[model samples]
Target: MNTIYRLLLVTLFFVSQNNQAQKRIALFNQKDLKGWYAFGEEKGKTNNADELFSVENNMIRMFGPKAGYLMSEQSFRNFELTVEYRWNTDVNVVRKNNNKNSGVMYLVPAETPDILWPKGIQFQIKEGATGDFVFLQETTLNINGTKTTPGKSVVSKRFADAEKPIGEWNQLVIISKNGVITQKLNGKTVNQGTESSVTEGRILLQYEGFPIDFRKVNIKKSK
Candidate 1:
């Protein structure tokens, strides 16, 4: 190949990569929880604890007992999300097992009492299992056009290095695109999977009987 031709080809490749990386698809507003909706009621009335969902000293506090979920009003299909979370109160009962702790469920269909619409997946958020991926509502997803169950687990073994001490901030990043999902905690890739189908769904924060805080919730488009 000629020198000029090779140089031109390399430049074109670089430009294409840059454009793909620069695409900003999803983002969470840091000022307030204007784009989020809270679920559940206390004492037969909807709980409007603004302090529970508001920013205090630059941190997002999520506190409430029972089964309430703070969900994003907007739905999404494929994007990369970044959130930093920490627990306000350290209680061992909440993080005892996989089922009783707080988690970030994304790509979830509108939820109902009888029929839960995870039709998506979840990024596990707990003390020891911060970056685990669990199937929630996705019946199926596609990886390179191959159909498969969405809730399948790619990393059944726990990666124990990502968790931070209670009351300290831990970083979480989730990348979902074309049925492929990846979760990172504290700069390490902990979980990844591919689904059989894709659907638009909202993000839900779980209420696992303890108080947890989220400092940052941000998302962006992926290439």
Candidate 2:
């Protein structure tokens, strides 16, 4: 009995160590876009791109002079991603929408062209509708016990609004494991889906013609 109890203690120690090993590291170094690039509709990607996306005060500032996505240099899978963002309405000289819009896109396949909207899962970032999931380019996800059709956008009308006031920081957590995905804003699981058609690919921060700031872009692998 003594030996069995000792073995069980050893097992628990290993389990705790393993959980600590799966550390959530900051993707943004708070210095520069070292491991990211830009792709957009115009004046971006495979051209002399302007500073539509820049790093300021340890936060990623999307000027949105041109609409585009700041693509990560690496692809990810089976991970939990967290980011803090706020609308910089103070810097917007030409705010496109009164309801400001942007998004965090994941599982963007590299084979597809970098159009305005590539095939991936988008956690839509918008006013009064921040937690909506936008399936782009025929992407699919099962939500609310119903299998969403290809190229369909399922509105999370049932989820409660979890966004902070404008200009205040809002934390968005996205967890994708196996084929299941969950979107949480301000600590609320506002949207979730299963059996996603997309499982692993690159991530993007959309610059949808609105000044925004993102910080603490961190990620950890999910079990």
- Candidate 2 lDDT: 0.82
Residue lDDT tens for model 2, 67-163: 7878877788889999999999885355544558898999888787778878898999988789888888888888878877776454444276899
Tell me the TM-score of model 1.
Answer: 0.69
Tell me how many clashing residue pairs each candidate has.
14, 0
Best by lDDT: 2
- Tens digits of lDDT, candidate 1, 77-147: 77788888877664543332334367887877765331222345667776566666566543554333555
lDDT of 1 at 5: 98
Model 1: worst 10 consecutive residues (lDDT sum): 111-120
Q: Which segments of model 1 are wrong by more than 4 Å?
A: 1-28, 41-52, 90-100, 110-119, 138-160
lDDT, model 2, position 145: 82
lDDT of 2 at 96: 49
